[model samples]
Target: VKQIGNTHNREMLPSCWDLTEAVIRHLLNMTDKEFFYWGEYLNEKAKQRQTQYKGPHQVFQENV
Candidate 1:
């Protein structure tokens, strides 16, 4: 049970990481087109993460 919980947590990490990367790029003045592309990628990752996600972050839920 502990291992399964750990694995689920690991699976959810990528979406958060992608979101952080995108936000950092935005702060760095990344182009809108480039940011959109990254957003799309993050959206995909968010969907995948949704399968095992249990967090209450509204951004993920809204985007997903």
Candidate 2:
């Protein structure tokens, strides 16, 4: 896991794991209003990048 994380630019893997858990906990504790706000924010961001985004399979094939 550490090796993969390093390859993916995760300089501080240990801290990343802790932060991930914290984010999960925060998400789980979010009120409905907070959750919906984040959901819409993410949706808007995704839409803005939809044209430039590529799936993992496409990226892998290009690299291969």
Candidate 3:
């Protein structure tokens, strides 16, 4: 295993698989309201950027 930071902000991931596993675990742990809020935040941010760069408002919930 490798530690990525100091004690106050450390991450211990043994492999690349651990990174994905941690990400999925965190996402799955969010409440319905939190997830919706996160999606809305992302969409709004994307919309702000869309004015300057044409692209999709990539949502994180549906794909997860």
Which structure among the candidates has the greatest lDDT? 2
Which candidate model has the greater TM-score, 1 or 3?
3
Q: How much is 59 displaced in model 3, in angstroms?
A: 20
Model 3 lDDT per residue over 1-64, tens place: 9877676443553567888899899989999999999999999887777666644543443356
CA deviation > 4 Å runs, candidate 1: 1-26, 52-64
RMSD of 2: 11.3
Q: How would you encode candidate 1's per-residue C-alpha lDDT over 1-64 as one tens digit per residue?
A: 3444466776767787789999787667977787888889999997788766766775666788
Spell out the clash pairs found in candidate 3: none
Q: What's the candidate order when arranged by decreasing lDDT?
A: 2, 1, 3
Give the whole-model CA lDDT for all candidates, comma-separated: 0.77, 0.79, 0.76
TM-scores of the models, in the order given: 0.37, 0.53, 0.53
Point out the higher-scoring one by lDDT: 2 or 3.
2
Alpha carbon lDDT at 7, candidate 2: 60
- Runs with alpha carbons beyond 4 Å of true place in candidate 2: 1-14, 52-64
